[model samples]
Target: MKEDELHAFLTLQRIPNLGDTSIKRLIARFETAQQVLDQKKESLLKLDGIGAFKLKAFFEKEHRLAAEEELKFIQEHNIDYCSYKDQNYPERLKHCIDGPILLFKRGSKDFSQQRMISIVGTRKVTNHGVDFIKQFVEDLAPLNPLVVSGFAYGVDITAHRAALDQGLDTIAVLAHGLNQIYPKVHAKYVKPVEAQGAFITDFWSSDAFDRTNFLRRNRIIAGMSEATVVIESAEKGGSLVTADIANSYNRDVFAVPGRPGDAQSLGCNNLIKTQKAQLITSAADLIYLLNWQIEEELKPVQKQLFVELNAEEKVICNFLSDVGKEQLDLIALHCKMPTFKVASILLNMELKGVVRPLPGKQFELT
Candidate 1:
């Protein structure tokens, strides 16, 4: 967007009562941020969802001054940004009713990747949670999906590192401005994350860092992805909030189940029980449920020679090798395994390039 238009958008953001959704309504009617700002109070109040109270600060001069200051900081830092209407704005986020009207970013400035997933959990993550994240990202490495997470402690940082270790792109959604990093200790990972992907936010450098900002931050993490995975979360935590937000967005949510007595497991279990999220034990379940297809060229040429299969996988492989092709239910019935278990195993086998899914849920050895 041009400088003047960006300034107009920033000014709109600075208004106290006007939010993204309300501002969007104004933009739709006026066609541009500048145009909206130029309209008289009587004109703006006539629009649906607009009220006299919202327009009380609409013509304030302080907002325009704040926008100028923020614009200067943006230019000095060489920050990259995109308006909601820009072509490069995150495609999925664009559909969110309350998604930020403007997003400031650093690093690659690319939102082109179609296969993005956000992994989130409590800041106080368990060892088991860390292991799950590492394995999950590694197993998903072949598909080369972009990983998105808040750059905080525990699950978020672990997910980001796992993606980086696997040479996958990762985006860190921040609660604060790009001027500084939260927790300060995580400053070390800044450059590495920027090199691999980006750090994006709607908050400006002048904004104060507050706990309340995290709720807003979580929305970006949920809004930018096709799915959100809760590796571990307490009964009440920000990760669960992200899961709720993801569900509200009508996006798929996956939660890893934990032991019955574990405190961290309660949130995930509740989410699953409430039908707010689908239960996922492994990356295979996500890939299967999402119906993400492996590229033909990316498939391994020799499955048995290099890939290792467990007892159940070997049984499925042998059965498919002999039968040529079979449906999921028939394979499960003949193999004496539960249909859900067989489904997960088949998905794992598909990832290993040992088999390929066919029409009507049939599977054939590759």
Candidate 2:
């Protein structure tokens, strides 16, 4: 975003009652942040959800002054930022109505990776949780997914380290501003993290550090990724909040099932029991559930005249041949079979070199 537009966005953020969603609503109607600020009070109040009270501080000069100070800080620190309207903003986050309007970043890595997943859990992660994370990242290394976490102790730090050790890009979402790192002890990981991926936040350099900030930070963790994984959690924690936010965004959420009696497993167990998250035991389960194993280069294969086929496989092959390419659900619907059954048959066909998987859960004859 240009300086003037960024300044306008900062000014909008400074307004006491106006939030990201409200700002977005205004921007959608006005076409730009500066345009929203230029409108008269009568015009602004005509929009739904914009009331007289919310606009009481909208025209205040103090907000502009505060924005100027923030702009100066941003320039001095060489901080990078992206507005929600920018093409570089996170693609998944743009679908979230409550996503931040502006995000300050400290690394060169962009959010263009095809696969990103947020791994979050309790700060009091157990030995088992640590082992699970390391193995999970190792297994997922081939796919080269971007790993995202809050950069706190226990589960967060472990996830970040696992991704780093595997030479995978990892994003550390902060609860505070980029001007300083919280937990002072984590200062060492800052450079390595910035080198690999980025440290991103919506908080200004001057924003106060508070417990509530972590809750706000959780949304970014959930919003930017295709899925959220709960490595371990107690009955209550920030990880659960992230899972709920992911669910609200209609993203897939996975929970590591633990022994029922373990304290850290309570939250994950409840999520599975309540059907808020899918149960995941390993990286293979996640890959299969998300259909992340589709090959990019599908080699051409001549039809095998002598290849034997079962009834279901023949049905799927015929359907794909007729439609050219079809998704798993559509194939299931037209083939008169359950979706899960069709998925199994497709896998068998893929192994038999009769078909190949495509992106977006699609399939076609080889």
Task: State TM-scores per candidate.
Answer: 0.94, 0.82
Question: Once superposed on the true structure, which residue ranges of model 2 sit more than 4 Å away at CA?
Answer: 294-366
lDDT tens digits by residue: candidate 2, 187-270: 999899999999999999889999999999999999999999999999999999999999999999999999999999999999
Top candidate by TM-score: 1
Clashing pairs in 1: none
Give RMSD (Å) of candidate 1 vs. truth: 1.9
RMSD to truth, every model: 1.9, 6.3
lDDT digits (tens) for residues 146-214 of candidate 1: 999999999999999999999999999999999999879999999999999999999999999999999
Best lDDT goes to which candidate?
Answer: 1
